[model samples]
Target: MIVGIDLGTTNSAVAIWRDGAASLIPNSLGDVLTPSAVSMTEDGTILVGVAARDRQSTHPALTATAFKRLMGAQKPVMLGRTRFSAEELSALVLRSLKADAEAYLGEPVESAVITVPAYFNDRQRKATRRAGELAGLRVERLLNEPTAAALAHGIHQREDKEPFLVFDLGGGTFDVSIVEIFDGIIEVRASAGDNRLGGEDFNDVMVELVRGQLKGVDALPLSNSELREIMRAAAERTRRGLTEADTAPFSLVWKGREIRRDVRADAFAEAAAGLIARLREPVLRSMRDSGIRTEQLSEVILVGGATRMPIVRRAVTRMFGRFPNASIDPDHAVAMGAAVQAGLKARDSALEEIRLTDVCPFTLGVDTVEFDRLGRMHSGVFCPIIERNTVIPASRVHVFSTVRDNQPVVEFGVYQGEARQVDANVKLGQLSIPVPPRPAGTVRIDCRFSYDVSGLLEVDLTIPETGASKQLVICDDADAPDDAAIAARREVLAALKVHPREDAANAATLARAERCYEAFLGERRDHIGQMIIGFEGVLQKQDPKQIKEARDEIERQLDALEGERFL
Candidate 1:
């Protein structure tokens, strides 16, 4: 069976092509959305999805969520007795989803079309594919998340004659794509986004607000664990509230006092001003690169949960001079698109025969040496192989020669990104073209870069004169640690007495949470003076056991307090 998976940062969902239609497979909880969280049990078993997320309030450290942000990062995180590289952690999540799909279909599932953010660079894209392999599944193709959403939209409106933009703001990333559909073909003219921005930032802002309210009181002593649980729950509530209400109220009792604060819609908007502003450049750049003006785009399709905020909707409308099309649920559209792609892959659907053309989000180049006036070799010259916005499933070639006499090898260090300076871009990897012992500029090495629909790049280096060559599958970087090293690292990580399962980790995570809360309190001391007075009253019961219980109760109140802005 072939399936489509949206392995989101905060949550994930899987869909399959069946009965000539796309269907989503719900997790054990009967919910389509599964939190991208993982929890390890005392027996070394791993629990994924909603179960892991449910444990987060109690076991914050053991439960790893939002690891997607760390994709391509050189660092690995230690969890419990197990240390997991970013790819392994992602595999755990994907494996869980695959299990759910297989059970639903009563058949073994093999290949899949996974969706990724449109702006993911080569390293990140490669990491995603590796994750799929680690999960024991073959990735048929890597579809851009926004492109999938566009496919779903286009399928729904096969008769509509208008160009649309897909604005996807997921849990940990945001991407805006401009797509045009004509004669059953979906062409992505341009795409852009910030991998670091998403719904998590909004929650962090609310968490800070609540921390300030507690800090205003001069007499309250709050534990870090207590503050974090309160803030996390509060941030979640605030995020939900902003979806509908004009004002949301958050109230909590710390020590023996009652604390309350109402976060108005306007305040929520103000808090997210910086994040919202960041979206402008990407949207404008996508449009500008596509050569499509606001007037030319017939509709804007919002995809992802973050777009549910009225503030976001209004900002998009103001920018495009038209309200976005919200007929399709933002959260489900990407998965639906993924399913559609699966159907196409399976060749089992009658949906209009459509071909999608995507582009590399970043530039592809090589690092070369240049001579200075002093005749020193400087190695920062970047010769681009494929420029950004070029059609995908495309390849480009560049020719270079050895600068020194009798140089037996020409080393080409490949890079990705639009930055002119080598330090400003991602050094993907390198390929060395072996040449015969020849004098300066005597050998011609042809370097070719081929990018597929999955956004994976492959480089082929050929010594055309001698017919000697070397090829590299871009996703397979030879220098990256192999499975053995990664496994050894994981074993070492597991033995570090990492924080315990859900509830135990929660305590330590709460401490970190409290530090963040206190920092917020110090910054916003003036606005929450009254709330602080009440917050301290509840914290005076200092018995450890009682404090723990009271802290949980108080955190619930904070959750309610932050829930006001959207609901």
Candidate 2:
């Protein structure tokens, strides 16, 4: 059976089409949601999901999270003694989701449709697909997150044919889409986003607040993850609390003195003014690029958990002059919509007439030189062949000539972005075209960029005079790993041991206890230590029901202990 996976930055979920309807598949713990976290134990045991997340603070060296933001970057995530790329970390999350789906369905699942941010370029999209392949699943399709949300929204709304805007703010990325829904079709007109903006930024706003109020914070370098975790954990808890209350108080032991501060909801708003301003730009840009008036949009839909914030909602309202639709749960819409797409890929009878089309999120262009009035040449100018927001499965061609007289070779630099200068854009790759020793103006080559539905780019350079042509499937970011490198990394992953499925509950419980043991004082800390020992003894008895009951009781105690320690 094929499945739909939302390999999100902070959290992930899986769904499938069953009984002529889409359904979410529960993980081993019988929960529909899973944390996108992975941790490696000192003994070389690999732990994923909740078990891994539990160790993030106490076992920071062995733990890694939020690698999704580094998807196509050249930097590697250094965990303990090993270095891993963002895609490799993502593959671990995918592998866990795959296992959970198979366990629930009681069958082998080999294919999946994954979701990506609309603004992700060709390299980032390829990295996502490569991550899926590393997890042992053939990627059936790469669906845009906002587009998936539109599919889900279009089905529930009673509109026959209407245009709407989708405001998507996830943990690590934000995307906005202007789309039209009609005749069993969801056609996306334009999409825009910043890969680096999201809810996590708001959390950092809270962190900055605490840092300012607390003295001697700078004395402790963040290289100490333990110290950083304590600060961030308190910030995160208080930030989440602001969602429910006007003011939230956070207490933390600092410099041998207890520090207390009340963070107001409005303060977070002011600190994040720049970020909120960013949210406004894409809405206006999408509207302008699509040639759609704000009033013309039938409605505005909100997707992703970050949009649940009152501040974000208000920002959207002020920009579009409408209250965004909240009928869809911001968190679940993307995953659910992915399920619908999965069904479409299977050619499910239910969606026979529905067709979806998407647009390229950014401009594809190359560099050029032009002479000024004074006869001096400027070489940094960008000439776009395919403008941003062009519909996908698109082909565009432009002719470029050699640089100087009797130039032996002509170089074609492939780039993607909206910058007006060549150096300002992201260089995907370059191809050198040989033209038989001709004058600069005499030799010209046709450069065409073909973007497919999956968001991959294929470039073709054709020489008309000699009828010589060359094609390029641009390697991701110029430094992407080859097949041999991937194979070697796979072997390293295979060598590590994964905790047994049956033992996840125990591992999670122990990690939680240790986490609490770090935060509390005296009697409470000793009590948690005792509980861990007791739970370990109970697990050795090989009693499933007994272990579960003990685990639950201890978890409740741990939660209470942590609650009392925090604000």
Candidate 3:
């Protein structure tokens, strides 16, 4: 059976189609949502989800989170003594989710439909697929998060035909999609987004606010990693609190003293004005591309957990002149919709009547040369073969001639974007084809681009005279690992000891206590330090009852000191 996975930046979840409906699969901890965090212990044990997230403040150097923001970048994340690419870190999370699904379903599941931001570029999408492959699952499809939400909301099942907009603001990415549904068809008219904008950026704003308040303090290890983590955690808590209350305290304890600042909702809104402004362009662009005015929209649906913020809700109201739809749970909608898509892929009887048609989020084209009226030739011009928002599984062809007299080879640089100049667009790949030595504009070549339902691109070039042809499939070949390399990395991951699932509560409590120990000083610090020692002694005793009691007591104390986790 194929499961649906939401491999998100802040959290991840899995779901499956069962009992004629899509339902979320609970992990070993009996939670449907899992924090997308990974950590390595000093003894070479790996940890994922909440246990790893708890270690962020205590074992900052060994923990990695929010790596999804760098999905396509060639960056390395260091955890303890090991260095991992973003894909590898994501694979660890995917592997954990796979295990959870298998355990929950009592079957061997190997295929999945993973959700991604609609605005993700080709490289980022490919990286997501690669991450799934690394996790020992065959990635059946990469579904757009917003589109998935539409499916999960059962928009296609409605008898009325109407247009709506999906505003998706997740942990590290933002996307806007214009959709229309009629006659059992859910059509995505347009999609646009910013990969860098999300809830995490708002957290950074809160972090800055707290730092400004503590500027007068001296000799505080503000630059320390653990302290940074502590501040981030505090900011997340305060942000969540501000969702319901008009004012929330952003406080941190250091050197036996508590430094605090009460942040009003207005102040946060003012400080985050820049981020709020960034959400406008994509929304406008999506509407423009879809040729739909605000009045034409039947409803503006909100997706993603970040959309729960009152600040974002207010912004959406002002943009659309209506309260957006929120009946569907923002966090679970995408995963559930993905499961629906998985059912569609499996041709499940319950979903036999539903159909979905997606759009190309960006333009796909090749570099070209243009001659001005004065006969001056200009190169690096982008000639689009497939424009943005075109329905998927589409194929388009364009013809071109040789640019220079007797040019030995015709070079085609494939790019994707809205720029008029090729240099301004993202180059997906390039190829050179040898041609007959002919005068300029004499040799003609046919360029055909095929984009499939799964978002893969194929470029075909043919020369009529020579009957020569070539095809290029867009892929990140330079960074893609071979089978042997993938196997080696898989072996490395499999060889590491994974923390026992049953001991997760104790591990998480201890990790939080360690962080509290690092954040406090003087007597309170001493108290936490002693508690850590006592807890370690209990753990060493290997007595379940004793350990549970000690862990519960520690968690209660930490709750008094730092409050419960924000989630």
Candidate 4:
């Protein structure tokens, strides 16, 4: 059976298309959204979701979360003596989702339609597809998250002629898209986003607020883990409170004393003002790129949990002069849309009557001849094959002549991006076509660029003069390490001796954090002294084991404190 999956940064969800409707499959705990966290028990068993997240307070060193932000990154993450690529870590999450789906359906599910941010570059998209494959699921298509949300919105309304904008701000990514619906056709005219921006930024703001408060108390010296654990809990609560209340009450026991603070809506908005401002660029740019004015957008649809913020809504309303649509649950829209796409893929319902066309968010181009000075040949010209806003399922061809006479083959460098210089763009891959050895001008190579609904690009190099050709699917050839290699690396990663959960690394992190806190505390030593005394009171009641445990917790809090500054 075909299913839909939303592999999010902080959470993941799965849904199936059945009985002409879409239904989300809850996890074992009956939660529609599962935390994207994993932890290994001392016995070697792997735990996912809430159990893993719960362990973060006591075992922050062993738990790994938010790894999704590293997708397509060249760096490797070291975990439990095993090194894992971002793709591999993502695969584990997908595998967990797949297992849940199989249990719900009472059958083995083999294929799915996965949703990604519309602005995900070729490398990031390819990594996501590979992740699905590693999890034993055949990815029929990779739908854009915003586009998928738009599809769900369109399906619910059954509108035949109207245009709307979809703004998706999830845990770790943001996407803005403009879609036009006409005669059962849903076409995405433009897509834009910052892959690194999301609700996490809001949590960082809260963390900073707490750290700032603690710094005012000058006498206490807390460890990193202790500070991180406290701040993490505080940030999480603040994020949840923003969804329903104008302000959130925050309190945490630090250094022994109970510290209390209230975060008002205005303060929250002020702290995140920079991020809110940053979000407007993409919305305006997307609208302009789609050739659709803000006034032309009939409705602005808000999806993803981050959009629940009043600040975000106000920012978008100011830009479009209209209240955004929230008819569909923000958290469920993407998965529902994925289910809709699954229905189309499985041909299980009449939803197949609807068609969608999406475009590559970035420009696709190649290197060409620029100019020569004093008997020299310079190759720096960037020739674009397709511009950003062009409709998808489209192809463009460019011809280039051999620079040297009797050249056996011509090399075509394929790239993606809008940079005029080749160095500034991504080198997707290269294509070389064999041709009859003839004069430079006698050989003709036609380079064709085609992007499909999945946003995957295909490049074909043909020597129409000699009827010789070579085809390269860019996604299939990127220098990603194979699954076997990744697995082998993971084995090595697992063997590496990671610092103990309560090791000296925690102390060092805490030392650095304490310095920052002390610097910030300045003259607030009296308040800090009271809190430190309270912390010691709690510490005195604990046995040696408990003191060590408290120390570990304190270290985690410190990490959270540091994380706030960096974020």
Task: Give Cα-based local distance difference scores for all models.
Answer: 0.75, 0.82, 0.88, 0.76
Model 4 Cα lDDT, one tens digit per residue, 1-567:
889999898888999888878889987555788778766656655566655655555556666778888877777776566566787777777877887888788999999999988777778888888788777788898889998899888888887756789999998999999998898899888999998899887888877765665555632233576467556756877767766798887755555465667788887788888999889888877977988887788889999988888888899888888888988999999999999999999886578679888877888988887545675777766789988878877899988777778888777788878789878887898878778888867777888999776656789888777788788886532565777965664565345333232232222333333343442343343443443454466556856675666655654554554343211
TM-score, one value per model? 0.80, 0.92, 0.94, 0.81
Whole-model lDDT for model 2 versus the true structure?
A: 0.82
lDDT of 1 by residue, 1-567 (tens): 889999898888999867766678986545688778776756665667655665555556566778999987877866676677788888878877887787778899898888999888777777887788767778888888999999888878875456679999988999988888888888888889899999888777776655565555623333555445545655776667767799876654444445667788887788778988998999988987888888888888999988888898999889888888989988888988999998888887486477778877888899888888999988887778888777787889988899999998888778988877777888878778779998898889988999877555789999878999998776633444687865664465344332323333233223323322332343333323433444345446545565556556544544453321111
- Give the C-alpha miss distance for residue 38 in model 1, angstroms: 1.7
Which 10 consecutive residues of model 2 have the lowest summed lDDT? 474-483
Q: Rank the candidates by TM-score, best first.
A: 3, 2, 4, 1
Model 4 worst lDDT window (10 residues) = 498-507
Give the C-alpha miss distance for residue 121 in model 1, angstroms: 2.3
Q: Candidate 4: what lDDT? A: 0.76
For model 2, residues 311-359, the per-residue Cα lDDT tens digits are 8888888887778898988888898889989999999997787788988
- lDDT (Cα, 0-100) at 251 in candidate 1: 50
Q: After aligning candidate 4 to the native by TM-score, how far in Å is the CA of 197 from where it should be?
A: 0.5
What is the TM-score (0 to 1) of candidate 1? 0.80
Q: Candidate 1 at residue 340, lDDT?
A: 91
lDDT of 3 by residue, 1-567 (tens): 899999999999999987688899998777899899999999988899888998887789999999999897889999977999899999999998999999899999899999999988788888898899889998999999999998887632456458989899999999998888777888899999999999999999988866766655533455899778878888887888899899998877755577778988898898899999999999999998899999999999999988999999999999999999988889998999999999999999887778999999889999999999999989999999999988898999999999889999999999999899989988898977899999999999999999977777889999999999999987433347888987898888778788776776677777778777876777888999999999999999999999989988987888887667644
